[model samples]
Every structure is written in C-alpha cells, then in structure tokens.
Target chain A: MNHALDTRHAALLLAPLTLLMLLFFLMPALSIVWTSVHGGQLDLAAYRELLTSALFRRVLATTFEISIEATALTLVIGYAIAMHLARLTPSARAVMMIFVMLPFWTSILVKSFAFTIVLGDAGLVNRAISWLFGTETPIPMLFNRVGVVLGMLNFLLPFMVLPVLGNLLAQDRTLQRAAETMGAGPVRIFLRITLPLSLPGVLSGVLMCLSLSVGSYITPALLGGRTDMMMANLVDFYTRQTLDWPAASAIAMVLLLITALIVVLLTRVRGGNVEVL
Target chain B: MHNSLPDRMTRFWRATGGLIAWSGYLFLLMPTLILVPVSLGGSQQLSFPPEQLSLALYEQFFTDPSWWGAALQSAKIATLSTMLTMLIAVPAAYALVRGDFPGRRFLNLFTLSPILVPVVVLGLGFYLNFNLFGIGGSDLSLVIAHTILIAPFVVVSVSAGLRQIDPALETVATIMGAGRATIFFRVVLPQIRDSLVVGALLAFLISFDEVVASYFVSGPSTMTLPVKMYSALRWEISPVIAAVSAMLTILSLVFSVALIHLQKKSRGH
Candidate 1:
C-alpha cells in the first residue's frame, strides 16, 4: 500500500508537467508533421514541391554555407579565447567570462539593432571608414552578408566560448607541462595534446553554432539582403507574410529532419559508444 | 635545424593567437559601444558620434505612455512566465534527477526539443493553434509560449544543482526519522536554492528578450520592448529606438552581473 501510495504521489506530481509537454511541446511538433502531410488528404506533394524548388535549394545551400563558415570561425576564435581565459587567474577568468557571456543575456533584437547602428551606412563603421579614406559616401555594410554574419557571430560567440571553456577548465594542465618538459614546442604541445583532448568541446561548439545559425531568423531577416536570406527567414516569410501554413510546415519539417541528421552524424563522429540518450 | 624551426613556428603562432584574441574581444564589444552615441543623438536619424548630443530620445522613451506600457507588459509577462517555469521545472527536474522512472529519457528530450526547433516554426505553430483557440493575440498566449520556451533552462540549471548534491545526505536524513516532507524542505531545497534562483533569473531574462514568438502572439496591448522596437525599425531608423536599446542593454548587463555574482557566491560556499 505504501509503495502504491509513493507511485501515486509521483504520478500526481508529474501530471501537470506531462500534460504541458504533451499539449504544448510534443503536440505542436507532431502537428507540424501532421499538417505537412495532410493538407487535404495524405499527400507528399508539399515535401516533393519543397525539395524540388530552386529557391528552396538556394536557401538550403546558403544556410549550410553560412553555418559552416560561422561554425569554423567561432571554433577557432572561441578556442583561442578559452585558452587565454584558462591561463588567467581565477578572478580574472571570472571577469573575462562575464564579458564573454554579456551578449548572451542581452536580447537578440537589441544585439542585432546594435549591429545595424555600427554597420549601417552613416553608422560607426562607415563613418570611420569614410573618415579614414576621406570619402564622401558611407560604405554599404548593412543589408548584406557582412551585417548578417557580424550579427550572428555577436550572438553566437558565447555559445562557442562557453563550451570550449568548460572543457578547457576540466582539462588537466600537468600534461601540457609534461609535454613541454619533453622538449615539445608550444605549437606542437597545443596541437598534439590540448587540441586533441579538447575535441569534445570543439565538436559541441561547432554543433551548437551550426544548429543556431541555420535556424536563426531575426538576425538574417533584419540584416541580410534577399540574396543573404537563410532557410529560417524563408520559413518566416512563408508563414507570417504569405500565410502559407502548409508550405511553412513542410519547410520546418525538413529543417528539423536535417538538424536531427546532423546531430546524429556528429554523435557518431564524436564516438558512437557514448549513448546519445 | 628542425628544433629551431619549431621554436620559430611557436613564436609565430603565439603572436597570431594574441592578435586573434584581441580581435575576438573587439568583435564582441564594438557593436555594444556603438549603441551609446546613437542613443544620445539630438537628430532624429541614427548617426554615430551624433552631430548634436541630447537626451531627448531618452526623454521620449520615458515620457511616452505606449513605450512605458509596453515595457511594463514585458516585465509582467517575464515575471509570470518565470514563475510558471520555476513551478513546473523544479519538481520535474527533481524527479528526473532523483527518481527512478520509465520514459525519463523521453521526458528529458521533450523538454529540450524546443531549443532545437527554429523559433519561427514554433511561433507559426503557436500562432495557428492559439488563433484557433481565440487567444492568439493575448498576453495569456504570450505567457504560455514563453513558459514553454524557458522551462528547459530552468530544468537544466536545477538538474546541474541536483547533480552536485549527494543523494546519500537525503537518505541519511530519512533514516534519522525525518519525514520525507521535512527532508525535502530542509535538505534538498536549501541545497538547490542557488540553482533555483539562477534558473529563475535566466528564465526571466529569456522571456523578456524573446521577440519572435512575442511578435506573433502579442497584440498591441501585449507588445514587448523588443517587439515594439522591431516594429519601429520597420518604419524608420530613429534615435529613440537607439535609446530604448541602450536601456535594454544596461538592464541586461546588470542582470548578468548579478547572476555572475550569485554564481561566484555559491561557488565560494
């Protein structure tokens, strides 16, 4: 009876959360899949059309290209910054990390807006560029790939930095010292010892940056030109502007599927022995 | 020869590394610095190192009723969503961490999947669903959407805190004849209090900053600061928007500092 009561209490405690998960989270996602398939009857036409569309292909290619570049840039920069932080004293490390994370806490809208102020024509960068060059015309920086990439990197830098920092902090420093004592150069030691050991962090950061960059809507929409648009911007354009729910749902399902596949591929590459579950 | 070559390479890499590090810092800080002068511009246009410096934009933000009302609405929604997230996530996190349960893995995935899905996708789905229910353009819908969005952060934070605690401590308290309720209230809750506070703060910030979902679900009465700024941006590039953004930046910085301070204090404990 006591065991039964314990089970009952657990069930009661979990019921509300379970209900929310079912109704709000799982249901919405499944509904997207459902809506995509059954616009009128069971049909693969939406998927077929989306897959074949040249615009869709272009958007997909743009998404992958931008995400890959962003991921690579973030990993290299983030890894170096994490290494620098790791070498600092604890208090300094804390202060520096706080700086690194400041943008993460700020609104994405605010960050993107701030970028516009810096990157826009007559904005800071253009003003400075014109002043330096003694030119009358402000450089066109906004409404371009430069603005979108800058905005994305501003928001995403911390995501890259934090995971790498976590792994770096957890690493044993004595091994690097040992490698140095054995006449291993700093570059060699870093590449052979630190970098190899930090693969998990690098992998995680890359995955995060890729996933985030691919799905980001606000940054690209506000900053990017039509040619600079990502898949997420397309999804928003379809759903919000055109009121094309079925097409939007189809695109979303494809995005979700592609993201899942990437995660799977990443997990396998990282180590198939580790249980993703 | 190879030894000297390696040494030279190391020196080159170190210099390159330092340059990259400085660039990274500038990249992070430069955009934020640009907001200040733009906010203070006397002219209506957003120009850096404004031809004239004035506080009119700040005044506009403060004096305008709609701006203040939207700010208040954002605060209200953030508070309500934070509370809801904490209530739901704490118990769920505790169960997942401490209890043996079937489908716990699935439950964990369910909590995290929201983070994986594009915000626009979620926004569209919610818009469709909420419109059908007649709550599409309501504050209630915004709160619900935000709670779902932020609950995962609460769960992650609380779960991290739970992992640091020793389950044996709770077991010993129970063996010493403490009631289950007493053990939970006295032992478990106190141990995880820092994480709970951090989680709640994070949830508040996340909900406060959320724009995509807010844009879709919120009515004019329910417009958040970000949503308001976004709409304003579509129409014009104004110094007023800059002032509003600067205020938000300062607010976010203060909250982040407070969170970091709390984390440091807990670490010291």
Candidate 2:
C-alpha cells in the first residue's frame, strides 16, 4: 500500500492475466487467421475455395436474411418492453426486469427444445389449434424457417431490452419535460427527441442481435428444416464434418468481417451520439 | 384542468403500451419454462401438461452414468476455470483500478476483447490451439478454453467491487506502515469479498452453461453437460434431456438471481 502506483507496480499486478491472454487468447486467435492465410503455403487458396463455392455463397445469404429478420423483430419487441421499463417505479421495474431476464437465464438449447415442442406437428400450438378448430390433424410448424426465427427471437429479446433500457434510463428526462412544456405533441416529441436520443442503445442492441443470429447454430440445426443453415453451422460443419480447418477459418474470417462491417456502419450512423453501451 | 386531447392521448398510449410491453415480456420469458411441465410428463414423449405427473424421467437422469459423468466433468471444468480466472482477473482488475501506468487503457480493452468475438470463432480458435498439442479432448483443454472466456466477467465484477471501495482506506493503511501485500490481504480483500464470491459463482454458471465452445472442444470421452444435452437433442428426442434442461434452467435462474441480488446490494451500500 505504501508503494507508489507506477508502471512497475502496474506491470507486476497485470502479469498473470497478461500471460494468460497471450497464451490462450491472442495466440489462438492469431493462429486461426494465420492458418487461413497459410494453407500449406502463404497463399489464398482457402479464401478462393470459399469465394468460388455457390453453396457457401448461399449459406452467407441465408445467414444474413435470418439475422436481419430476427434483429428487426427483436428491436421492435424489446424497445416496447424497455420503454415500459423506463417509465416504471423502481420496484415495478425490478419485477419487470425479471421477466426480461428469465429467458436469458435459461439455456439457449432449452429455448430451442421448447420451440421444438411448441412448433412441432403434435406440439402445444397444434394441440390448441385442434381443440379450437375441431380437427385432430397436427399442423407442421417445426423444422422450418418460422421455428428457427422464433427460437432466435426468444434468445435475443433480452439482449435487446437491456441495452435499450440502460440508454433510456441514462437519458436526460428534463429534455422531454422541456419539450412537453414547449407544446410539442407526444408523437413529435418521441420522433424528434426521445427516439433520436436512444439511438446508441438501439444501434448497439441491433448490432448484438444481428451478430448473434448470424452466428447461431443450435436454433437452426434443431428447429429449422434442412435448408435453414446459418454461418455458425458452416463453421461447425467445416471443422467437424469435413475436417477442413483452412476452409473453416476462411468462412469464419468472412463472417467476422461482415459483422465488423455492420458494426462500423451502425456506429458511423450513430455519429456524434456516443454514450455508454 | 379537464382532460385535453393530449392528456387523453397519453392515457390511451400508456394503457396500450403496458399491454404490448407485458405481452412481449411474457412471450420472451414463458417458453423456456416449458421444460418444467415436460420434465414431469409420465409419458415417454416430451409434452406439456404431462399425461400424469411422475418422477420417471428424473429417475432416468439420476441413474444414467453418462449424465453423471457429464455433470461431473462440467462441474470440474467450471470450478477449475473460475478459480484460474479469479487468480488472473483479481490482479488485472486491481492494476486497472488502483495502478497508474502506460498502456492501461489498452490492457483494459485486451481483457474485454473476447466479448467482441463470436463464441463460434473462439471455440474454433480453442479447438485449433488444443489440437496442436494433442490436448483437444483433455479436461485441461476444456478448462483452459473456458478460463479464457470467463476471465473477462471476473475482471468486470472485481473492477466494480474496486470502485465501490473507499480509496482512503488503502491510503490510510499505507500511511500506517502496512506493506502493499499486507494492505491487499488485510484491507482491500475484505471490502471486495462480496464481489469475489459472486464473481466466482457467475463464472461457474457461465462455464456450466456454455455449449458452442464446449461442443467444439469436447470429444466423446470429455463431454460436458450442455454438450451432452446438445448431442441428445441432435441425435434423438429423449425425455431425460427435458429433465436435465429443466434442472439446468432452474439452477441458472437461481444463480442469476443470486448474482443480481449481490450486485444490487453492493451498489446499494
């Protein structure tokens, strides 16, 4: 305690963690990129293989399509909940926060399993439907894009609510009060003032949702039909099925770049409204 | 004043907003708890509102060796990783909070960089790293991989704890002739012990629940609980998995509640 807080003291304190990161994290991550570049030699064959394959191209497209759909839906639903949360008193907010967090606490696999039953032909939804419509035939809902998207919808909703709620709380309330006093309509106030101010949360939440959906494997594999594959499945398939590290590394790099690109674009769009995420 | 147009409008929107918001929350929350009912189903098939309430599936989960092994393996990995993460993150977070040095900001970012990368990529990185050493299926491999992922949370929790402490306590101890190590052991650790306990628990829960990375690294012999459940889900619809899932969900819910409660109390102080 008597020692000065200097570079030497800091370095000493940081050594164990720094060494851990170097050995396990940085080396492994760099090695993947390094492997992708040096497939038997310093060449671009892996990238070329990925680029030339029509199947890989389609998988990329499908990944984005599903991710975008899930991200948009999550933002809308989560914004509604977060807005509600921001308006509540502390005790009420705490109760409502638990509801948002319940799915988050549960495993993603459990949610997928629940949907497998909920959306299956003989599952709960169809059972209810048959009861209402006077029919015994089970509706085929699982093993499709709808089920896949719904599974992801369950997983990402909390991620959306949390960041948006944080930004909404951190937001200045007097600005809205000022707008109210100035006779701005509620719709106008929301559109021009409140919504604009919550952009950082909205932007970050969307980015998180999109990235997660794109990389998701379990939902698509367990809930979706054969055709609904996301990028994570591609990575898993390459690494496990084909044992193609080079190809896997290439596709992974591509996926990471796409996520990075989207993140950069959104942060750019947020412009000068930098705030804590 | 009597209700104006704007007043009436606000009232209407408020009512509708509450309905939509509550429905969205229920929609997000209720699906996962489906396992609770299905887990109790007396029938062989997974179903809600069980044909009859029974502990048959729970019995199966309890008696099964594969299930037991996976659970044990998961617990072992989670414990080892959490301990290792604490060992590293305590000092790292301490340095970041209390020390003054060059590249401090960069070190902070480095600790948190894992959160930016997708789990699949990290899983792949770990898979490759371990494969080179022929430790791909070893417990050490799983522990190390999970340690890397869980360490960031430890740093965050400890740093939060660090912020909650009064620096004057450490400064006073320093002036009273306590050495740096003595101050850390006797003064600083006592103040942040809540964070250390809760942080370790959170890290344990995180490692226990992790699937994607565990899936990549775990082989047949070294499979963890989540990975085992994933395999069961993929291979067939086993009712036992429903029991396992229900149990996992409850455990996670309790752990999260405890962690959040601790965090709230810490901040309340």
Candidate 3:
C-alpha cells in the first residue's frame, strides 16, 4: 500500500525523532571520534597508545578470549535447551519459554549480585561441596573468569535459544518423516535433515551471543578480577579511575569498529540464510 | 516403538537431553530466585538459606535514605525518559509506518543505530558531550542519554502496532473530513493504546535498569539505584542490595507479565 501521508506531513511528523537522533545520538558519537584525535586537532596519539600500550593489548586479548569462550559455552547449552523446546507441544513450549525468558526480565545487576551470592567462597555451591566432601577449602569461583563466564552465560543464553528455537520450529517435519520412511535412522535423519536446516539459526545465535559477549560490561565489572577485565571494563577504568578521556575514547572507537565489523559480516552471511530459515 | 537398539538409544538421548535442558533452565532461574531468601536474612553477611529469616533487610531498604532516595531518582528519570522517548518515537513510528517521506530508509536505520553502538561507547560519548556543554553529571543529561538509548525499542514496538492497524481507518477518517492530527489523536492513538502502554513500560524498564550511560552521566547528587548498586557491588557485596534485588525482581516480574498480556492483546487485535 502507498503511504498515507504526503512528504510534507511525514517530514513534520518525523522531525522530532530526526533532530533528537542527530543532536543527542549522532553528534555525541562524533564527539568520541573528535576526542580520540586529540580534541579535533587531528592527532593520532590516542590511537597510537591504544595500539602500543601493553595493558591495552592484554585487555584486548582478554576481551576476545573471554567472549569467545562465553559464546561457545552459550551456544552449546542454548542449543540443547532450544532442541528440547522444539520437541515439546506448543502449550508446553509456551510454559517453558517463561523459564527461558526469566533472566531477560531481571536486571543484570541483580543477576550479577545473585551469582556472587551463589558462587562466593561462603556461598551456596562451596557450602554444599564442603558439607558433602568434608573439606574445609572452598572452590574459588567468584572474582574470576568462572564468575564472568557464568554470568554472561546466564545473560546470553536467551539470545541464543530464541533464534535457534525459531529456526528449529520453522524446519519442515515432512523431510524428517520422509527420511525415516526411507529406512534412515533417527540419528541419520537428525544429522542430515534437522542439523543442516538449523545451521542458519545456530549461526545467527552465535553472532548475537558473540557480539553481546564482546561488549558486555556489567558482568565482568561485578564478577571478574583485574586480569579478567573485558574491553568495556577497560573503558570504564580509563573513563573513571584514570581520568583519561582520550585513551577512553580511543578504546571506545576500537570497540565500535569491532562491533560494526561483526554486524556487517553477520548481515552478509545472514542475507541468504533468511529464506532458508 | 518397542525396545529396538536405535529406539532405546533415542529414548536415552531424549532423557539426558531433557535433563541437561532442565538444568539450563534451573541455572537461569536460580540466581535471581535465590536472592529472596538471602534478602530475608537478618545479618550483614551474605549467605544463602538464611541463618535467621526476618524482614530486617527489607525494613532497612524502606528506612534507608540513600537507597530509597536513589530508587526514587531512578523512577523519576525513567518516567521522564519514557515520556520523552514516546513523545518523539510515537510520531516517528507513525511516519515510518504510514507516511511517505524522503530518507525513510535512512531515518529507520538512524533510529536503530544507537543499539548497534556499544553502550559503553555511548556512555563515554554522552560523558564527553555533556562535559562539553558544561552539563555533565546532571539528571537532565542522564534522562536525555536514556531516551536516546531506549528510543529504538519504543519506535520498533509502536511501528509494529501501527502496521497491524487498518490503513483504511485513517483513509476513511480523511474522507469523512478529519485532519491528520485529529486522526492521530482520535483514531490512531486509541487503536495502538495497548502497544503504546507496552512500549512505555519497556522504555521505563530499560531506562530504570540502565547502568553504563547513567554511571557516566549521573552525579553523587543524582545517583540512580542501579548506579548506586553498581558502585556498591564493585567494592563489596552489600546485604541491602539483596533486598533491593528482590524488590526489583518482583517489580520486573510484574511488568514483564503485564507486557506479555498487553502484547497478546495488541496481537489479538
């Protein structure tokens, strides 16, 4: 259908949002680039520091390392849950979806705090372990990589599960039935028909999880140690503790670039896969 | 269906898969749910399965000025931002969905651009922008930043609502001599009220829960609950936060269920 409003009225309606985005969103974003280049004097000193600084390099490495690990773990666990959800009846799936979506409703800070409560030295897990095994030493979980990954897995699992489940549910059941009628075993049918069809969903889920993991701040800040800091934590450290705006903006620029690159690549890969799913 | 080797293996796989899947669900629900009992504990120290079950922490949250003060401030800011976001996003959603204009695609993409940017970057950008304007660390700055952060969701939600409505209604209104503004206020708004409410609730929740940008923009004078919780959590795990967390969990649970209901209503329409 054709648009209801003509250009003049449409422009009038759209003006507020356009102006808001430009003034608040676009200009502030540009200010980051300007600040990164020595307050618009066109110097690359901040970028140079980002490239050469050992601390920055290690933080970058840690960011990628933790994100990749978290993404892998989320995909594995998320896929299992999604697969199970797909097999259930629709009414059952609707009930199970609430459990899947519970984390999304809770604030990240609360969830992170909950993790600390559960995983701390005197927390429930250690208490359970010590009680059962008759041991005094608690397994160190909090303020480490384990805590960060666990928190991230909780936050990111829904992102992975929803997309994969969408694809799994969208798959043709007749193909599986036809394969079964041809004497193909359940395992073979799953491997050939279901798994291959679900690849797009898995890919989309992976990209979403990986992107979220890479830029995540709250989890790492609350649950991680100094060495376990992600790029976002580094951004916070530079912005707040060190009072280094240039260094912070430079780091921000790098993060923005990486995220944009991933999104661009994902869209390219996802273009053809849309119809398949 | 009988116990052939493949059928038995399939059953075993289903059983184990269900176990693992349920374990994953437990992991998702456990952390947040565990906070309730922790909040009920009567001690300074944080422990699960509370040593003494009491309403001590809950009482403290209500009585404490700093915690309650921050909560009120967050509510104020979230409300303002939600209003501001809807003020802009509703019209934009209408235009994007029903109005023909130049740069329509560009406008759609521009609205969503904020979500693509890492929030930390947006936080820093706002920090710098507000500092440049000499308005850094103000409630107004935080409100503006939050509106920017959450506008896209409102726009998307309202746009979906707009799409589902019949265009013929507007066309009929126009044919019967109603103006665009009249139709929008009289005809369109009522039709999309459920979505608008859902979107507003979502905007409220997001702005209230926002931490990264608020951290940079809010000052000691205007510290939000999440920002306060964040700083406190960074240093030490405060027992009071468990009460705060429990309350927040309940609040979000209520809003989320309401949102689900409103969504179903919107879709059902």
Candidate 4:
C-alpha cells in the first residue's frame, strides 16, 4: 500500500509540469529547429545563404562589437559599485543595493523610452546643450550607435552588479586583512587576492551580459539607426516584414549556434563552473 | 618606490575608486529621473522645463476610454499569464528538487533554454503556430506565450528555495507517520511559501511588462500598454507617453521594493 501510494504521488507531482514542457517549451523549440532545416525538404540552402550574405556578416560583427562594449562597461562600473556595497555597513548596504536594483525591476521598455526622451534631438540633453552653448541646432544624439550603447548599458549594468555582489557577499574579508598584515599593500592585496577570488562572479556576469546583449531585440530596434540593425532585428524584419520563415529560422539557428559556441568557450576558459543565473 | 610612496598611492587609488563609484550611480539614476518631470509638462512636445505644469496628460490617460481599456486588457492578460506560469512552475520545480529521476538535468536545461533563445525566434514560432490554429490575434495567445516565457524564472527561483530546505526535516516528518500529502502540505508548503510568492510575483511582472511577444500575438483591440507606447513613440513623443511611462515606473518601483523586503525577510528567517 505504501509503495502504491508513493508511485501515485510521484505521478501526480510530475505529470502537469512534464505535459506543459512537452507541449509548450520542447515542441516550439524543436519545431523552430526542424522548420529551419526542413520546412519543405532537406536543404542546406538557407544556411548557405546566411553564410554568404555580406549584410549578415556585417550584422553579426555589429552584434558582437556592441555586446563586447556593453559587457566591458558593465564590468568596470559594476565592480566599483559592488566593492562599495561590500565595504558599507549592513543597513546602508541594503539601502544602496535596493537603489542599484531599482532600474532592473522597472520594465526594460519603459527605461528604453526614458533614454529616447533624454537623448532625442529636442530632448533634455540637446535642449540643455543648446541653452548652454547658444547653438541653433540640437545635437544628433539619438538614432546613432551612442544611443544604442547607452540604452543597452542601462539594462545590462544591474545584471553585472548583482552577480558580483553575490560573490562579494560570499567572500571572506579576513584574507585581505591577513595580506595587509603580511606587509602587502592595498593594491597588491586586491590584485593578487581579492580580484582573483572574484573571478567566478566576474566571469558569470560577463557571460550573462554578453549573451543577453547579443540576443537583445528591443533596445537596438528603438534606439538604433537603420545602419545599426543587429541580427535579431534582421530576423524580425525577415519574419514579420518579408514573410520569410525559412530565412528567419536560419538566422535564428545561426544565432543560437554562435551563442552556444561563445558560452562553451567562456566556460572552458573560466574553468567550467559558473551558474549563469 | 618607498614606504610613504605606497601609502600616498593607495590613498589616491581609493579616491579615484570613490569617484568612479559615484559616477556609476549617477549614470544609473539620471535616465530614470528624466521621465518624472517630463510627464508633468503641459506642451505637446517633450521638453525639460515645462512652460506650464498641468495634470492634463495624466487626466487623459485616466479619462480616455482607449487608454483605460488597453490598461485593463494588459492587467487581465498579465494576471492570467502569472496564474498559468505558477501553476506550471510549482509542480515542475517540486519534482526537480525532490524527485531523483532520470533526465532531470535535461529537463532543467529544456526549461531554461527559452531565456537563451532570442525573443524574435520565439515570436516567429508563435506567430506561425498560432496562425495555423486561427488563434494568432487572440488574448489567449498572448497569455500562453507569456506563460511559456516566464515559467522558467519561476522554476529557477523555486528550485533555489527547494535546495535551501533541509530534506531531513521532511524525512523526519514522514517517519513520524504523517502521510505524504499531509507532510507536503503541513511541512513542505509552509517552509517554501515565501519563495513561491517571490517567484510568482516575478513571473507576473515579466508578463506585465512584455512587449515584443505582445506586438506579434495581440490584435488591435488586445494590445498591451507597452505596445501602445511603442506605436506612439515611432510617430511622436508626447507627454501622454510620458504619463503612461511614469505610471508604469512607479508601479514597478513598488513591486521591486516589496520584492527586496520579502528577500530580506526570508534571509533573516
């Protein structure tokens, strides 16, 4: 009776989630991969087309360039903030941490719109510049790479800060004190001890920011100019505007492949143990 | 290259670090602050200092039927999507945490891969599949799409909570002659209740703020607030958009504060 009851409980606990995954998560993902390859027949033509297209090559390069810039900026800024939080009194740390997280909890779309207003031609920055400089023309800040990078960094910074903060909280401060007592200077201790110890968190943050920034669709679309269109935007245009599923799926597959490769390379270089979440 | 030189260099580095940290804080805060005053502007175009300050735009958002209707529809979809995500995530998280089963690792990855997949691809897949079923532009489609998108976050959070619990507590309760269902309800549920709430709240927020998926799946009448804002921003920047954005920003801040409070309380406990 106990065995039978155990089996029944297991079945009851597992059935719903399993069914949902099979229907929604697994099926849709599989269908996307399958459709990309065999929407009509077994063909490498879509893959071939993407590889040979100069437009795609440029888009891919731009995606990587933007993601790298965003990742680098997030790390430098996030590290300083995390260090400050670590050194703060507990109550002050908590309050400041909440402030750091404020933008993250807000919708990315809302924040992007805020950037648009602040950076637009007739917007605040330009208006302020015109008043100060007595200039007739508003600065061309929006619809450029500067606008897109600023918008992307606004979203990516929190992701970088949180992971590094988690690692800092988990760190032992006594080691730093011991190093100081052993005649090591503050810079020497930080470089030799603290920085190396925080590598796990730093790598985790880098991978997370890089992947998200690369896959991001909305920020670039809204803040970017026509020439700044990334791979995700191209996928959207092909699928929505051009009505080309095969081509869209092909682009997605390539995106997935590149992302997967980068993740693999990151893990390998970082010693293969980082939780991305 | 001497002892006093080291002290001076350390002090200089500390000041530089402090300066960078404060600048970073400013970078994060300034963009968010720009929206608040703009929402209060009286002009049709967006401006920094208002020639006139009026509540007319906020009033328009409240009094206008189309705006209110879109807000209501978005709220309804978000609510339904949150419910669906919680329903799916809780049991899945439970099994992954407690059940020692085959393919569990694969299942975990399968659930999370949605986040890694580009949104455009997911949107395309839904557009095609929903169109084939004749449900492409329905409210139900949006709800289902968002549920899939957010369930993984729910799973991760709840699983983290599960890992934190001592399994021996549950084992002891079982050995005390409590039935499995009784143990699960009386012992397990109460322990993880806070985490479950946090997870569900996060799911709700994700669904509430969703835009790209809604843009493709929603009909004209079923458009969410973000979709409306997106369409408007493409043509013009008005204080009305600012009004809507300010409302959302405030709501999100409230939720974020609550989430932080809950997290601190849970950690304390």
The number of the candidate with the highest lDDT is 3
Using DockQ as the measure, the top candidate is 3
> For each candidate, what is the lDDT?
0.79, 0.83, 0.87, 0.79
Query: How well does candidate 4 score on lDDT at residue B88?
Result: 69
Per-prediction tally of clashes: 0, 1, 0, 0
- For A145-177, candidate 1 gives per-residue lDDT tens digits of 877877888878898887788788889989988
| Superposed model 2: Cα runs more than 4 Å off | A1-4, A129-140, A174-185, A262-277, B1-5
Candidate 2 structure quality by residue, lDDT tens digits, B1-269: 64387777777777787787877976776665577888888547777767888998889888999997899989999989998888878988988988877777778878876766778988888888888878888898898889888888888888889988988898899888998889888999999988998779878988988899999988889999999989899997777888888888788778767867887788888
Interface RMSD (Å) of model 1?
A: 3.6
Sort candidate 2 into its docking category. medium
Number of the candidate with higher lDDT, 3 or 4: 3
The reply for model 3, stretches above 4 Å from the true place, is: A1-3, A130-136, A269-277, B1-3
Looking at model 2, the pairs that clash are A1-B180
Report the CAPRI category for model 4.
medium
> What is the C-alpha DockQ of each candidate?
0.47, 0.59, 0.63, 0.50
- Please tell me how candidate 3 rates in CAPRI terms: medium
Candidate with better DockQ, 2 vs 4: 2
